[model samples]
Target: MPIIRLMLVFLVFKSVLSGVYGNNSNSENDSKVLQMLIDCGGSVTSLRNELQDMKDKLERLRSEAATDTYIRWGRSSCPSGATTVYDGFAAGSYYTHSGAAANHICLSKKPKFNYHYSNPYKSSYIYGAEYQTYESIWNNLHNHDVPCAVCHIPRSSVIMIPGTDDCPENFKEEYRGYLMSGHHSHTAATEFVCVDGHPVTAPYSSKTDKDGTMFYFVRAKCGSLKCLPYEEGKQITCAVCSYSP
Candidate 1:
């Protein structure tokens, strides 16, 4: 449409020039007019190509901005249709340690180190995480080393809702699982995280309470949290959701 409009305007200008010059125009003026028309046509072709290039760039930017990434705790693989960035073992600070990070980390299986720093004095440590959900819905996973994966979803945003197993309206559910955190009685408090419902353990990991870091299911207390929607002494559930737009 832009090119068509440009052509119409150019045609009207040409008609005006033709009327002004009539048959009394010199050969030099006619040659100049021909060159001017050629230049206008070239400008229109160049502008069209630039416009197409700009459209292509916008499409690429939208695609690049659409992705969202998160860690899939207690599972070594991502949900169907999601891409795995890296698969690793879940790790965190010692349960009794008070001077370390309060958050968990997914340590890559194949690590690349620039240089090793060997410290003789006591230093903060992160250890392999284990499931402590005994006598509960995740009893089967008790004492098993937890595995984790970094997943990338082709969506604009991702969120972890701790109180419900279902995603909110207009969002796609990436996974649903139990809300887990450190033991309430532990000296060091930790942030809660969502673990996959059907979790996978690390390969060749033994079923023992090594207890470097522990994962315990979180329970709700209805006094301040309200009883109609939440039940006392009931394990909380969680859902990971991905949203587009």
Candidate 2:
């Protein structure tokens, strides 16, 4: 009987503390909502309803985009943007040996993508260019389509650069470490750029001959109209980006 009385007293004390700490239905519900969000995957319909509600609220403020903000690029935005002006599929993939040709999507703002995946560098087959194809996705934007095609793709095809058996003598340890660290994105080489200026080039060497060709897999980096699209195999340089070399 004494133990039971103590247990009841503890429960009452706990309730009193909770009340003193400003407990309310709204706060409780909000906490429940947050937990629901954390456990979001299991409740598809509820999530969809929540998303739809968000979309409805968003539409009141912005122009109605054809796709949801979180929707995959090509799945909805790409074709939707392309079809906003034209009548055919623009960003469809079909066993691509190379990505779209002569496209550039670099701009101050990243246009909606057909597909976006985080940490794309380690995923061998994924390729996202520094620019998206403005011409292809023009209808989706209010501004002039700069018509750039920076590709972001995952490339797993193993075409080894034949000449590269060792690292360059002056290759910065920081750059090498950057690669070894499994961080996919390399920057303006503020940290370290290739001596030859092609950071993603093949064989880790500037040398390109019949035995091996330098291959560059691309990723989508931040840029603006300054970036113009080139073909998948087309060699680009500081001059091509209009660096005034």
Candidate 3:
């Protein structure tokens, strides 16, 4: 099946800041908290720490609210003691074989605009992403406008959906949102270009976007090496292969 189920994989990242509270919304309580942090000169990191506590509480509530989601879609047991939690997170960011997305980053006025890798493998789930993904949301994490599709997948053992399987919790998308990243090898799945040259990405062991628009060469008829996702500034297209893993 096309990767429709998405897993709420737990991903961990470096603690630069705790979390950004949504203050502009109708929640007066949230507005007060944001003002308090700003007035107290709380560093973004420190504020996020405080906000994280709130998230933890919310997570508990969310977990309780959707207890069946964990049981149904979450991993109940690892197969033959496979090591989960790559780098303390069940999920994290990765470059896919034919995946395309804008990497959020921070920009200092540079004499020239160019793209260079910080070293793709060296990219971390939390800290490094601050430059490419989170921070890049709108230059220095200032703009809170980001829209993305949140796809959930079930546990590793449960690849295909059975007739009786339940769906995972539906998370409300935020202007600035949360993602389970830590997926280094997941995006590296063995995707291939068709003989007709259309990009064909394989299903991830964990999860993948069902909406095929994320892959650059998805519909393009480029067989084998003839298929290449056209890369643009601050955005890119690539393939993911899981064959080696």
Candidate 4:
């Protein structure tokens, strides 16, 4: 009976030891799980911050794109009742006499002096009474003149007294005034005479004469010349003017 009691006590001690080991193993496992969960939460937070940074960068780029500033003036057509007298194309915000930009003119299309002499001692001249396309005129000017009239024309005439008598001597009288063919018809369309040093929207003026003729004046600024609308694939250097009687 004593031997049986001792065996029972030994078995009870072994059982308690097994229970303690099992509890220790479970506690270690729970600690490992908690550590893994904390690590996963930290990684999630890092990913969210990275995503927010990327989003902020994308938003800044979008804002900058939205605020980008550049003005583009589409093709312009010549004034009514008149055809293109010149054509030109320039690049950049500014222009120069001898630089990246180009200036073009059509002097051949200008009015020609139709001499009329009542007597041998006296003479008269008739200028610009014919209707010609701006392209044809530009071709004529290009073929006839050297160095192109757009660049060679006097700057004083183009800038100081535009559409006035200060224009090139050959085309001065024809630059402005009434047509010999039609007493009521007149020519006051602004020409792209010279380039400005900077980029600017050309200044314009519109007026109606008592004769019901509408005049449009597109003045050049910022060292760049004014441009007019022309046929497809062609650039015309003339302003628009409309007249209705």
Candidate 5:
């Protein structure tokens, strides 16, 4: 009887060991499956993020391409029989009038404008003599009362015509009209029609006066004008012009 009992105990122990080994094998297989799933999920997430970034870049490129139109014309494109009156670079500076109680710049003598001078209000003005180079204007600006100035290269001719609201003949708008700031505390003027005898205008007609103020014309259309960097206060004006082909 004792011998029979020992054989039965040994059989029971072997059966328990076999069950434990089977459970461990199943657990190992389950762990491998879970790891694979995790890796695949991470890859999918990374791919989605990359695709979104690519889409954003493509959209920005398209928007820039649509509005980046600037036609560059040389001196040869002037109208026939046109007498070039002022054909050099021009610079203007804004300053506070000593007793006039206004902030403006006077360019009457520099370009020799015969018309009644319209003093447009501005915060800062370019210093030094007229028609200064960028470097010279920059240097003079530092020593002046206001540290900001506007410079331009103007080409204009004296062709008399009835004053009309339209842009001058033989000229085309180069850039969409927009307000340009001196990047300072004061706003600059935006309504001056002729710079160094050149017929020019802000493509879109509007006014603003604020720090860091700006606007861009959409679709080369005049009506879609909007202000930027804040919408309140007076705005300084800047002009963009090009010779007509």
Candidate 6:
């Protein structure tokens, strides 16, 4: 217990003892009572320290739980030092649908369905994402269904940096790849994402033109956007980086 609380407890105990003893004082009895108080104080201090230690441990666990998570596109696994929350297929809206969502999603491999079927009418759909362009840097994973993994890293923040495959200083690179999104002239727009450098197809996947959400390699057109560090017709690279402070 705290020193102030311990002192209060000691004072209370002394008051109770004096009330009971009522001036029938003996030195031996007083010594025994003092020793008892010291023993009790030690026990209280030990218990308080243990409780404080447990509180510290719980705080650490909470910090770890509030982690950084991101989707590792074109890969079915997480990188080293990261935990795989789940491996799944990359899915998004059709590339030609003008009213569809602009961002992609990782569809869980093992999905749970509700007992009641809610929608019976026509609605928007999510289709499997595919790599539509071939690039030599990616080992030619063209026209293949993309696999994605949801990854988690404790006590960290992650970011995807475009234009260069290397991470910034003080940041650890999770994976590096080509930057991609829907084709420029497509009816539907899409947000750019970083595909894995060593891309892999989904399990039992084949090369087919099931034109869902497509990953077309991004290129730099550097007229207004910086031509010094970048050039036209050159494919842009991206790096997924994480920092733990």
State each model's CA lDDT, in order.
Answer: 0.86, 0.27, 0.26, 0.29, 0.32, 0.86
The C-alpha TM-scores of every prediction are: 0.73, 0.14, 0.15, 0.23, 0.21, 0.72
Q: Lowest-scoring 10 consecutive residues by lDDT in candidate 3?
A: 5-14
TM-score of 6: 0.72
Residue 165 lDDT (model 6):
93
Q: Which has the better lDDT: candidate 2, or candidate 4?
A: 4
Displacement of residue 42 (Cα, Å) in model 2 is: 19
Total backbone collisions, model 5: 12
Top-lDDT candidate index? 1
lDDT of 2 by residue, 1-245 (tens): 24475456545655665676666435565455445444543476677889999998986544332222111111111222222221111121112323322221123233465565744675323222211222332223212111212222111111111112233332211111010001123221111111112122111122212211011323233355233453332222211110010
Question: Model 4, 97-125: lDDT tens per residue?
Answer: 12212212232323356568434674422
Clashes of each: 0, 34, 42, 15, 12, 0
Candidates ranked by TM-score: 1, 6, 4, 5, 3, 2
Off by over 4 Å in 4: 1-25, 66-206, 209-245
List candidate 3 stretches off by more than 4 Å.
Answer: 1-43, 69-245
Give the 10-residue window scoring lowest on summed lDDT in candidate 1: 1-10
lDDT of 5 at 86: 28
**What is the C-alpha lDDT profile of model 5 across 59-122, one tens digit per residue?**
7775444321221111112233222332222223332222222222322223554466457565
lDDT of 6 at 166: 93
lDDT of 3 by residue, 6-78 (tens): 1111111111122342233344544554455444544655787999999999967754443111111112222
* TM-score of model 5 (CA atoms): 0.21
Residue 102 lDDT (model 1): 93
- Model 4, position 56: C-alpha lDDT score: 95
